[model samples]
Target chain A: MIGCYDFCGHYEWTFEWLSQLGGHTLVRAYWDEAVHQDSQTHASKLIREKGFEGMKEYWGPTLADEGAVYERTVTDDVFRIDMHECPSKGFLLRNGLEQYRDYCDHCMGWIGPLMKDAGFVIDHEHNHCGQCWWEIRRKDDATPASAAGELSGASDVRLRPGWQSPHTDHYERSTDPDDKTVVS
Target chain B: MASSIPASLPYADTKPAGHADFYFAVNATFRFILRHHGEGALRKYWQDIGQSYYQPVSKRWSELGFAGVAEYWRAFFAVEPGAEVEVSEAQDEVRLEVKTCPAIRHLREHGREVVPNFCQHCFFVNEAIAEPAGMTVRVCGGNGSCTQRFMKATADLPPQNLEDIATAS
Candidate 1:
């Protein structure tokens, strides 16, 4: 019945299906329209209304419910998350289900638009594994991503062993998924 | 929250039940497909997933017959938080009596708008999965609860009427 018990499986599969039907553009739209605007409207509403505090209220319980292993660091200027173990990506990895090219991009695909609407920008990086980090700030802050471990201290995902993959997708102060720089 | 684990489920995760928020994405995906593409495309997507993504399930059902269907549903529903389902097996068929559908209940409780054709997904998807196993499914009732029967192709059951399924709000 398309149950959520295995939502990650079908969700990833649907990415490729949508892309097959209408290339990358359609996939992007699905994330922005279906995910960010529709499915994740709760997050949008919260973050938009409460700003940094909303990210706290939204991600705290949500990540705990999804059984993610992560740490959140917040200050007057920024909200940061160090994702040590991302349950969604870990599910696909454990199940050996890879339909979309970069499943990690979906995070930015939806969150980027959400942040832009909230008048914020994001500094993010992911190894395509279950590990990633995010730093969200006001669009006018003009501060670059904190030096490794500078914001999160020992909890920084980039400082962990095996943090380096063959390629790491990096997003600077940006609010578009397409605005990414691939690094090796 | 599940008491037992069935060996037939293809993918296994560390958590007992999945986060219910995922149902939102499922519903959103259906709406997106229905809005951008036609109904035919949405049906194709469901059938395609059942046939392709669920290949292992069909293969196991082919090996274990009715027993596999019963076992798989038991495990599947177990992880679905708030699901109330019973799976029973007999000589020729397996029956799933869903007292409360987790997806529908969760979506409704949260006040999300569900697509009217939501319940039909079970039919198309399960039919695709059963076809490869030389089995068939007949579903009646929906939106919140339903009865699904998995029987052999030779069972001669009447074709399912779309009207039997209730429209989701």
Candidate 2:
């Protein structure tokens, strides 16, 4: 049960792409036993109880069968086409896709139609790709280490009150690069 | 007929070889700090030690003590919680009981090293990582859900002189 919340808008397109992955599927049911239309409720419960295996077992076969057909429809790489080509539509590729330029191009092409269909405001003013954004934010003045840390909220794990996990403390401590060494 | 100095010990006013040797050994030990613990962390840890940005600190490990060392380790390395920690003396300097059998298998089968699997909720390895066990990793966390096939370690490789470390044989 790959539980995903907020799938009402552009995520529907993502769901379509996910459907093509071999031996993976999305079921509109709970427990793979009960008939349920609310994918959110069913997905949430199914994820907590049955996990990814259950999601695959219920959805995989169907998606795998239609994999080729789905790929043909959403063919172009929706990301990495060009900032100018389709700036707003390119934001769909989110899985650290800096390596695969071709894949991003295909995704950008594929998702451009979907983005338009979804009615998201296409903002061309912001041409910054994810890597570019990272670099801009990581400038010395920006204090990116702290900003990144705060945004991630990787700190503040109050586990068992007064029994704070060392991991959380460690993360908080590392926020200050002066006091910490970034060892990969 | 006149002794220049009073001899209460084996030698008067002259330090023993062991005492001098201890200091010499400590000087050697400090090299490890520079090699691993970055100069910035060392400076922050020991503020008054006069560790300058230009002059990197390859000294002062003994002065920092165990707690300081622990903090250094915690900062530098990513350790999975369930990887059994065996601390001999200080709260730091723990021997992590990492089961590398799965990693070995992964290397053999996929030609890649596998990071230890961590539970989404607890951030600890779900079970003892062993051979024949699939390399299951943290799929999600409290903050956001993670999809399967996401290795805990990022794809970025660390800086290393691999050839120097490799055996000639």
> What DockQ does candidate 2 score?
0.01
What fraction of the genuine interface contacts, i.e. the true contacts, does candidate 1 reproduce? 0.79
The TM-score values for the models, in the order shown, are 0.97, 0.18
Q: Candidate 2's residue-wise lDDT over A1-184, tens digit each? A: 1011111111233223223321122211111111121212222344335433333343344333212111101112111111122211232232222222122222222222223223211111112231111111111232322232232132312112332222111111111111212121
Clash-forming residue pairs, model 1? none
* lDDT (Cα, tens digit) per residue for candidate 1, span A1-184: 7778778888999999999999999999999999999999999999999999999999999999888999999999999999999988998998899999999999999999999999999999999989999999999999999999898999999998879877799999988988999988
DockQ of 1: 0.65
**Cα-lDDT of candidate 2:** 0.22
On lDDT, the candidate that comes out on top is: 1
| Best candidate according to DockQ | 1
DockQ-based CAPRI category assigned to the predicted complex of candidate 1: medium
Return the TM-score for candidate 1, rounded to 2 decimals: 0.97
